[model samples]
Target: MAGTTWDIPSGATVKVSIIDSTMRLSNMPTTMLFDNAVEDFDHLDRIPTWCLLVESASGRKAVFDLGAPTDFDTYAPVYNKLMNEAGLRSGFKVEKDVAQVLQDHGVAPADVSSIIWRSEGLPVSVHSSHQHLDHIGNPNTFPKSTEIVVGQGFTKAYCPGYPTNPDSPVCETYFADRTLREINFEPGPAANPKIGGFRAHDFFGDGSFYLLDTPGHTTGHLSALARTTHGDIEDTFILMGGDVCHHGGELRPSPYQSLPDPLTASHYPVPAGLNITGCPGAALFGALQTSRGRRARDEPFVDPSKQLQEDYAASGRSIREAQVPDAMDNVFFVFAHDATLLGVVDVFPKGANEWRDKGWADTARWTFLKDFAPAAAKFGEEK
Candidate 1:
């Protein structure tokens, strides 16, 4: 058995909320719901910063995607005005962060045994998700004994840049959990599998939830997912996808943004600019270069595309990015920020107890994923 199978307990429940909802922070991340006044520009995804909490049969509770960067409210007037014009506002906090979230259900961050990030990226500032400061914003805020689960490659590939060793004081592996498989592979399996800090990972099996290597946006960037079955009639599902796509403009690939312009170099297709510095594609390209040199001949290196997420249309975040896991048919994509997702989904008002499984089930979000859980039963555990 890879791990525990899903046995929906009477006490076991998962809760999700939009944490941050501001557009005037640093640059409106591709995820935040910031509208674009410029006709030439794309619309914004003004989604609230959201943190997810899940309680297990063993009484263990965990949170996903802590909160966006703290400095989002301090933006200049021009940016704030633009965000306001586009219907953007801020409402993200930390103490009230997970504290309120937990208390609402009778819990606290201190009670949380672990805080597993969908991808470790800092709030509001750094553009990359693979780095420590990017993900483990203020480790002190978490419980003194709380464990941080950095995805396989995020743990390995990013250690070098940390102020200390990965196993040192700040960031350490929560478990021996590691792997190097392309999580997006169909049939739900792959090999050469040692956890790669450079690739993506799936924490436990049962494929209920896992990590994805969400490249293109950052060097060692990864995303998170949770497979859940909803509905009494058909037993549909909801998927919580963290940072796979920032906003509506990003869900779909855009001509790699003016393919040949230097000013737009940051947005070029992930595979095209392998020689650039500090880019994730460059890292894979560099790895290939090293491999070829050792072989004494030019060999076509490993393909980074294989490790990339297939689509951001909800299914884009799944294992094969094809069909929604069997347990779920409808999925709620918990993007940290995205105006469209925010516009479409209702944000629970403060002190209001009105909450239900109102996810992207009926909208385009539902059609985005495939139906796969029923077929995945045969994909069995492999060594």
Candidate 2:
């Protein structure tokens, strides 16, 4: 994780916007609400949404995750019920559909050369549980040439890191190629995208953006980062998040503390509630967030380590303590599911900022892999 690959274009600015794709399912519990005394929430699931646009340094446009299929409008009541429960209104009214959102933004699947999936396809709307339709709107509907990018271990589960957690309301029944193969139409390699250090393809390498294997959430829950050196990275827009944590909610104590109380037998997290067959401690140890960290302790619950173990194959290798390269400085991590301060990203409506506000910052950007082990050796909680 040391030595970031700065081969990407510099001085470019990459910005992101959270699009109102769809709200979370109804019947979310109370404990899960209010994620961020430091981050985002006041209850309700972090309605699985999509980040519409990313303008790279060269002004190239990239769409991170595509919104659900346009036909979802018919189920307006369910989604509306969800938003109403959250006590929040979407900034964009197009929640009815993303078709207009895409057209208004001038982005079509063909125009979008980069496609990074946070997880696999879920049939939730049509299927019960982590049904393929519940998530991953379906890419087969998109232009074939659009790159079908995904993390190394996307095949294991389509519920982002949900499958990894076990207790997740979503059932880890779907496979990547099994569920997602239907949506894929890319003409290029399905093998891993080239990323050495922070060195990524940029997809087009013009500074548009590329995916980084963040792992954890799933075996290879990847994060998309777009960099534009708006001045030095002292203030860069990074989105270091994923399903491992929702919004910034898991970062603090109040919301996280409430989690255990509501945990039930049916909805209890797989790892959190059950004892792993071979592992020694509690199964939930590695699955949920703790006062210490949201890791599955019994079997080295940090799913990211498994990704590293896979030789970075399926992002199942050992990325623990692997330092994020310096070249990633100007980048903003776009996977807001995890609560790492380095994750959640905030952005204004495209033209809102007098300045081109691309991402959010203020959280400490830990040093590279080279210094991490030693530094973390000294890093500790006051408790």
Candidate 3:
């Protein structure tokens, strides 16, 4: 774990609030997104899309990843047709847009300095993690002065969207009449420093926030690291992992954070007649490891399948790189669609800056194992 440590520069801290974007997808096939050959979960039900409200110390506010629009019709016709064909139309629903969620919390849409789709910065801008429909939201709701920010190569890949390109999944209206700024992660005077194996840009020109160039999910997929608390000896961070991997299982149990020896019933409750105390982590969930042949104790439960990823190999690399931060005790990694945090962490109206103090990381870490309870029960019975 020596080389895995993050050399974080001491600096200002930001206020982070987890926003329940109100987007939900139930009964989604696990196989559609992940390779679940080892972990046998049929459907990834109650999938929630999470956005973040990041406020810099200077009072500049930014919303990261707007979730989906309340109206599915807001998306491009091609995407809608694809959803209908895939039978995903019924499973998807959104009660409110991110803008409305902010308003309910007393934050006005106009007051939002920027909307980070997947990247982060000051001034009025919208930064998208990728051009995916669920993360794009409705940019039109914000004032035109609020520019849209995206990761590097975003415009080149999906610009002139929809009707203009006919096959584009993005809508041209997202960029119309607004300044569409794409991040340049190239190393130079702008300071694209290497942080945890990814080229990161200091969004605030301070160490408070960094937009990591985490590609693989898409052409310009991005992830973020927010310095929530600064201390003399250590700093706490919240990693806004935007679709790095849909499930926590895909990013956990790395060489740094292996499965706990005695997987307790509190975290992973088993059926009656099984071990009332607890079960050995490896014995209960060993088969869940996706690594072939000689399985390592630290291998993940699953890996992102090639079906949804634009670059499968790159995604694998990014996921591996992400494990470093995920394994750290001071870093709390939250995925965009981690339903495990539904009632676990405070959302929106409550700031998540104190995640460390509340021990949210340890509480939510193994909670994802609940998804494998059925499999664990079956394994216990066979013994």
Candidate 4:
């Protein structure tokens, strides 16, 4: 668990940049994401989609997660129906697709060597983190030479997509005339080794990037870890957590990184007239703990939605394992829909390799706690 360490070799590093997908899902019910037993908040005001551009030292480029398609109508009829049934039609909005965003940034689609999601290549290959519509994007936009990479069970689960499997969430056109490569993480003579409690494949074999087997959100959910700076006193990494947890509350306050005591204004701006300068961390956030067990303080504020998760227990383990690197100063964890990072971090066309030197982690770490302002205010009033 918390004691686990990553054995990242010292070698070539990659340049990573965040891409604002211009996709926004607003006014989503909080209950749809996690249990709202404590009733801290009613709705998630804004959910922004974030994608990443990874470039190896050798000039090979890859895009991680395409966010959402510009047009919602382009989705499979079944997926559209599901969204309508879930009453999410009005909430979903995308102003531009990933391809368009890339073009706007001066990076042509054809020049991108790979697009890793659940899939990865130059001529461009698309990797999908999972079969979710938001991440799959519109692979058809890329040249047919662009391959498609996916996780282990993806082919059997949703292949021959759409009309071929009427209920499929993906489109058959995505895989049409494209090379579909599925990553195998099983142990064998040439199998990928374990890195920090995860089965990892060295994508470039130069220690620049790795694709981790992290299932639970879906059948073939994948996450990536990129070495941004190496051959230094301490190597810095950016863990591209693909929906490991939607909100920061679900990943923070682990045993390794407990809530700061004597909570300060810098970490969280206390609402005015609280009549208190500083408060004990436990006392203020105690009620917000969804778990009543002994390790409630060490556990997350909220759990993953069972309805959306394929395996509830596995998802919990994945999140807990992620807490280890997250507590480290050298690792910066960014998930797909973290709105807290909207304007805080530099977006695409700007390299995120200097995150460590820029102190982005320290600034972004406690910002997520602002969402719990209401709970803190209530605690202050009671005090």
lDDT (CA) per prediction: 0.36, 0.37, 0.77, 0.74
lDDT (10s digit) by residue, model 3, range 1-383 = 33468876667899999999999988877777776534456887778888999899898888888888888787777667666666766777889999899998899888887777772211011132212457888887788777777899887777788788877777888778888878899988555777879989888777798989988777778899999997776888999999888887787678887777656766654544544345536555765442333254687877787766777898899999999988888898999999888888999889999998898887888777777666655665666
Every model: Cα RMSD to truth: 16.6, 13.7, 4.5, 4.6
- lDDT of candidate 4 at residue 246, scale 0 to 100: 86
Name the candidate that leads on TM-score.
3
How well does model 1 score by local distance difference test? 0.36
Measured by TM-score, how close is model 3 to the native structure? 0.91
User: Can you tell me which runs of candidate 2 are displaced by over 4 Å?
Assistant: 1-12, 22-24, 30-48, 56-60, 70-94, 105-110, 122-135, 153-201, 232-235, 252-334, 337-383
For 1-383, candidate 4 gives per-residue lDDT tens digits of 23536676665799999999888888877777776423456777668878999888888888888877877777777767766665666777888888888898898888776667642100011122112456777777677766666777777776677788776667788778778778888866233777788888777778788888887777777888999987446788999888788888888788878776655667755545544556435556754553233244566677777765676787888898888888888889988888878777999889899998887888788677766766665655766
* lDDT by residue for model 1 (4-70), tens: 1223211112333344323223333322222222111222223345555544435565566555434
For TM-score, candidate 1 versus 4, the one ahead is: 4
- Candidate 3 residue spans exceeding 4 A from truth: 1-3, 119-132, 270-280, 287-296
Q: 2 or 4, which is superior by TM-score? A: 4
Best by lDDT: 3
User: What is the number of backbone collisions in each predicted candidate, taken in the order shown?
Assistant: 37, 57, 11, 12
TM-score, one value per model: 0.48, 0.47, 0.91, 0.90
| Candidate 4, poorest ten consecutive residues by summed lDDT | 120-129
Q: Candidate 4 regions off by >4 Å? A: 1-4, 119-132, 189-191, 270-282, 287-296
